[model samples]
Target: MAWFRNLSRFSTINVSRRHDPFLLSSFNCFSSNNINTNPTIEKPSVDPVQYSGLGPTKPHEKPRVVVLGSGWAGCRLMKGLDPEIYDIVCVSPRNHMVFTPLLASTCVGTLEFRSVAEPIARIQPAISREPGSYFFLSNCTGISADKHMVHCETVTEGEQALDPWSFTVSYDKLVIALGAQPTTFGIRGVKEHAIFLREVHHAQEIRRKLLLNLMLSDVPGISEEEKRRLLHCVVVGGGPTGVEFSGELSDFIMRDVRQRYAHVKDYVHVTLIEANEILSSFDVRLRNYATKQLTKSGVRLVRGTVKDVQDQNIILNDGSEVPYGLLVWSTGVGPSPLIHALDLPKAPGGGRIGVDEWLRVPSVQDIFSIGDCSGFVESTGRQTLPALAQVAEREGKYLAHLLNKIGKAGGGRANSGKDIDFGEPFVYKHLGSMASVGSYKALVDLRQSKETKGISLAGFISWFIWRSAYLTRVVSWRNRIYVAINWATTLVFGRDISRI
Candidate 1:
């Protein structure tokens, strides 16, 4: 037993024969003698077991690159990064990245639930093990900027509670793409009661809840008022998410749920509540078109700030109260507490980090901030970039190009570029926007000169265009196919409302 233990201990030193001559000779002496002395034996030079944890360190992998969040900015950054350049790892609780624009369609079964979600691990170049790329460390709670470390909570399989897990990763560069979280505006009961539309799980949960409400309402013992309360759905904030979700809910209720359960046709109600005018950012014609389409679809529109959100009711700032079952809060943006916690150099208006036009934090050149969390000033330095997906996407591409230049330049000169030197100082190209109303009708706001405006199409044609555009925009072919099949099947039949 002692000799066996010694032999096992000797195996641990099998790093390199040149490094540990003693153990190398002990094993090699036996093997070489057995092979060459017998002349009938052939020996292999490489053994994976010896090199399992003892292989030559491959240049320390240029330090493990940890990306926080798998949202638009994070995913785009992962996609854009050259695998040969840095060892990449994406950290987010979600395994799949939800294509938010197509998410509303998924909720209504117009697009299959699976179609709109691209697995984070499956994006192109397949970040899993492409050269210097690796994906691990999913959950991030906080970061230690001084130490250049991230504090995370992880759990084992089937574990009920999360336990603290720590890993110290030294990075040559850090990209803070944590993105923005849902803002409740200090409104009571919003966080506890309402469901947000940011992630795939949220969408799935909404679908499940809607189905459960539908089925539970049909239960024999439930009262009419209970059914009404169960059936009514109110969506707060008339931004793209809120409006589209409302439209999806309306479509599901009118087209599928009503058809399937005729008894609840009159009971189902969806209200879109916006603090300001609905889709105010869009062209007035498009806004009016969306408002009109929503109104025509039996979906009610309320304009007021949400004063308070109760479990069963919403109190508006105007002192009006509306009863509801489901509440979807999509009011506005706030800095992700993750970013806010950094307590770094902040600009005006609530600690928002003001970055230069090139998207680098003024304090730290290596730390680049983009997306909603960053307030990047335009060339005139008068207005800031709007917190839109298009803006984030453009910023991401700009950063990628800049990083590519950095890679091309190499060495000390890589870090010496002015904010405005990147051609234009983040000129936002308005590529137009689109929002669905219900069932078939949608308003496409083509604000670009190259594109036309007020393209309203209803029924199958609009639906087809919507699906095609979104599917093309989905991260990868795998997701596109998954979503396409899901949409096709749902179109032919219906949603599988059964919960797991």
Candidate 2:
């Protein structure tokens, strides 16, 4: 009766006078003589639709911090941020942070994929629980610094058949930690044929391909040359990732493959192709030790430049061809296409997004950058920091503290932190390096630089130290436990060779 009385009042007041099509249609819907029964939706009028996005924050709401990545830098920043001071919004293609140092272990089944991946929610609970905080499974397409907004599009690249939609988010502060992509030196077919070891999925692909090659090589009618080619795994980088993967592959061939896939074990081989010396960042002695250990583990080390990459083989600069079943490209990382497209200033030498000593983008109001995507501007007279996980992690930690300090000073709003005294500039101190070279052998260099004299260790003791250090570095307790269990299982039962 109440609903009918209200409708009668509205109908009585304007039913006769109103000529609006929408209002007339509404009245017709309730007409007793000609009631509409169809539930099908009508098409909308032709008008340019506005993109839906998070608008500027109200005065009463907490300041929003938009982080444009989920790597070591962004995740660390989100973890340390004071959620009560600012709402967190993370935009990344992947929802988890890959423990990169241990990523190679996953490729050879020394560790499970899940063990190296810590979900974004697990790293920062506020993003999942807080009313204003959120995690977006998307890639940032562009940034509008003047408007304090970031443009992002959903990532629906896999099995899902949904179309990607674009959205924008306004932020009081924006942190760019998009990281970097693997360098291929403009070689042809590299992107189409070779896989890079930067993410968990990459490692998974390597594992799947390795197993597939092994099984295929064991086929009854295959020729000897074809079998050898199919079982040959070539790694194109001498850095930590490539070396470690080579070590893991050799270990797998010697231990697990020899016993389980005995028919193809003799044919399985690993070749590490490096343009220069492997582990060039470590001390000379340590590098020598790594080289020797890798060789002793049955990995063939090749010093040559890749001229071109083909589907089944690579052509060297010297007109030689190296056939391989699997190719991994880890020649180090450089700025991504998004970085190049950005109109912001870039650091010299590598074209990374430029930042001041305080990690703030100069001339920009509230934008900052870190991780492999950022570097110091030339004016700062500071050399760009190496693109290492520790460098990114520490930079993120420092920026979090700095932002929290600004928030406490009542400058958490966009364009309001101009006069705040940012206490200290970010100074990077090299914390040493560690790498595992199979057969219970490793290298640990504690020097601040190649010239600096400090503790450097090699052998099984170093391997033990490497394991203990990275085990503690795994993002969450759950993953740490997973990694430890995986390692133990591997040591007891050997590396898992299941293709799936």
Candidate 3:
């Protein structure tokens, strides 16, 4: 994390560079209570109407655009926008945008840990390298609609303390793209027991725990039963994330754990419990293929829901219990604390902030929301979009174009929802889904494309596609090489099991 802290030194914070740096142990999610009500910040003096392209503007004038979170949506908007014209400020807890697909690989050591995380500061050299554009890592507490300011808190660990931890980020055009968090679904003990797979720290923690379990199994005082229990890994939720993590875990056990602890090879077990069929989101045929592939790779598939997660054991809905050393929770995402804290119009069930075609939060015209944090209401039957990286990425690109059009047109404040329509409605294309099973096999469900014409592929070919796609999908050149090298190393030497 030294490099991570170092990346922010070049950003436009006016604070002194003398203080010690530390990664906030896990993410510090700031609720309204944790944030100070008032903080000192630079408010924009330029006329909003002229800066927003509604009125005439001088050559030197710039709009204050504040984007929350450095996930796909926030980063994409920053990358595409001309930072020189707009004074951009990014606020988030994490300093990097994790490549989620390769996160599973990092857990089992197929890829290096650093390969999956690209520093947020490097996302856009144009803005990140600018004199005043800042990509600050802080917790977004609340939005003051009356004052047009975002309340933020910077919480850090270790001995050295930072000055003025709480502050305000004022924006002329605001973007609330703070992404979602792992949902326990109100299940008992899940937060207390299970490990989430949402961020880089989660993957690092998984690796640490897995290595510890392996080493503990080899201890002399441990009985065979204890060792067997130590090898029981349970994965909840059968989505692509869960399936991909399960596959990587199986590969780790079969290749590394088995060879290292041959005596307990038969005892090592990986169980995947899903309320519905595994890979239910995929086409039926692709789902079947995934099931077959997972079964062949020695992963136990359980068709049930997890009622409760107790220490060392998970109680299923049917009263069955499965003991586990590692419980990786891959259940679907829910609204983040920031999202829940918002007082805005939401869907009937009340999960995400409801956004119209222009991705504007209701009642707040200048404020826009995107990514998993915002629940999109599509034109077609009011269908809610899934919380995927692809969806967030697409939404980011569209918002950039929307804002740029308004800026070019010299628009001002929206009088009503009808006034904000600068271009065509936002459209989300179904790109397709893919999951990797162990032993060089994968399942891919592609929508109608020029090449595939809507095809479902499985086995080695799909696996190859999976690797190639993710290899190129890495956001940075350094990360891409790191992943490629890690993959090559994994192929020749197997996954690294060292805990530290």
Candidate 4:
């Protein structure tokens, strides 16, 4: 019995060592003479010391390039950067980059959520494998341009017991690609009531709420008025996101809801409220076609401004009440609160961080800004580019090449790139625009601008082109296959309505 008890104690110590690697080393440090003979002896427990953060790189180490966000701009830059020349460190609240174009499809079961998300590790493998490169799941709180450091706090969302902790990272070059936030225009209850279709979680919430409303409206003893309000879907904004989502919702109703929830099929409806013309950026003809297409698909297009949002309905500027179970706000984006807090030079109109032709922040050394967070300085006499994904992506690609050139020229260090020639300035040429409006229909405008005359197509042919273009543009082949499979599955099996 004594030998068995000793063996049990040894096994318990071995299990503790397996759980905590440091326990084995600490146990080994105790000599036999120092070992406690009393089996009931207890030692005081001390909490483990928390890590501070990464310090400034030494002269012998590779210069660190710290990126702030994982959106289209930041992800593109990371993908194009040369890992051999510099160590990359990405800090963002989320670990994945969302494909915003197809995000609307995910809300209505046209495509699965995972198909529209690409992990940051897959985008830049060096961050996970390289000795110095890293990807921190945190949000940048502040930037110290003079000291070349950024203050960040970890994102501990959904883990109620674990409080977020702060850390600092020193960088040789800092790229600010922090994306913009959805603009609410200071409307009452916009933030609390209306859901913005930006992140993966937002789409998931929309799907869950939509499914729940559908199921609840069909329950017995529910009044007709209640069922109508519960099944009515409201979308505010005339942009591509709002229009595409309305289209997708209508498609789901016509195909899935009518067949699955036959009891309340007549109650399901989609209403799109836009103050101005839909697809305003497209050609006049394309906008007209989109309008006709949406009208034909049983979508009620209302031209009214939203005055207030309530729990179960919205008040329009004309004193009319529009009741809905689901309200999605996509009224475009503006600079985030961090951008407003930063004491940097801003552009003329949009309040974005001001950058020179080389995408470098004007008065800051070893710092650059791209994507929706950056704009050309007023002194440059250049118009601020429109906030579009294509613009951000191209800017990211250009900056990546520029940074690679600087690194090769021995300028990839703090305040060492002053003498390097930053070649020709970045020039953005408008690429084209495309939007899908359900029922196997779409619009494609290849014109450089609304003023320029280029090839513009509408109907089924453009729809094919739209799908083909985005399919090839998906970040990875893995996600491309996932999206393709999801689409095929949806077409054959109809959307997987197992609301797990």
Using all chains and alpha carbons, the TM-scores for the candidates as numbered come to 0.80, 0.92, 0.85, 0.91
Residue pairs with colliding backbones in model 2 are: none
Who wins the TM-score comparison?
A: 2
| lDDT of all predictions | 0.66, 0.87, 0.75, 0.87
Deviation of model 2 at 91, angstroms: 0.6
Task: Give the distance in Å from residue 488's predicted Cα in candidate 2 to where it truly belongs.
Answer: 1.0
Per-residue CA lDDT of model 1 for 246-359, tens digit only, reads 887887777788788888778999988887888876777668878888888889998788888888988888898888877777887878776777756655565566677667
Candidate 4 similarity to native, TM-score: 0.91
User: Which residue pairs clash in candidate 3?
Assistant: 53-410, 53-411, 54-410, 54-411, 54-412
Off by over 4 Å in 1: 1-65, 124-126, 130-132, 141-151, 155-159, 377-382, 412-425, 448-464
Query: lDDT by residue for model 2 over 38-120, one digit each (tens)?
Result: 64633222222334457788898899999999999999999999999999988898989999999998998999999989999
State how far residue 14 of model 4 sits from its true place (Å).
30
- What lDDT would candidate 1 get against the real structure? 0.66
Quality of model 4 by C-alpha lDDT: 0.87
Candidate 4 residue lDDT tens string, 1-500: 21112112221121112334443334423323234555444442322343235678788888899999999999999999999999998999888999999999999888999999999989999987787788888889999898899988767656442355555788999999998999999999999989999999999999999999999998999999999999999999989999999988889999899999999999998999999999999999999999999999999999999999999999999999999999999999999999989988898886899999989999889989999999999889998898899999999999999999999999998889999999999999998999999988999999998888999999999999999999999999999999999889998988866676
Per residue, candidate 3 scores C-alpha lDDT tens digits across 207-314 of: 898888878887788888888788888899999999999999888888888897776678788899999888776777888888888888899999998998899889
**For model 1, what is the error of residue 195's alpha carbon versus the real structure, in angstroms, after optimal superposition?**
0.9
> Residue 177 lDDT in model 2?
97
Q: How far out, in Å, is residue 247 in model 3?
A: 0.7
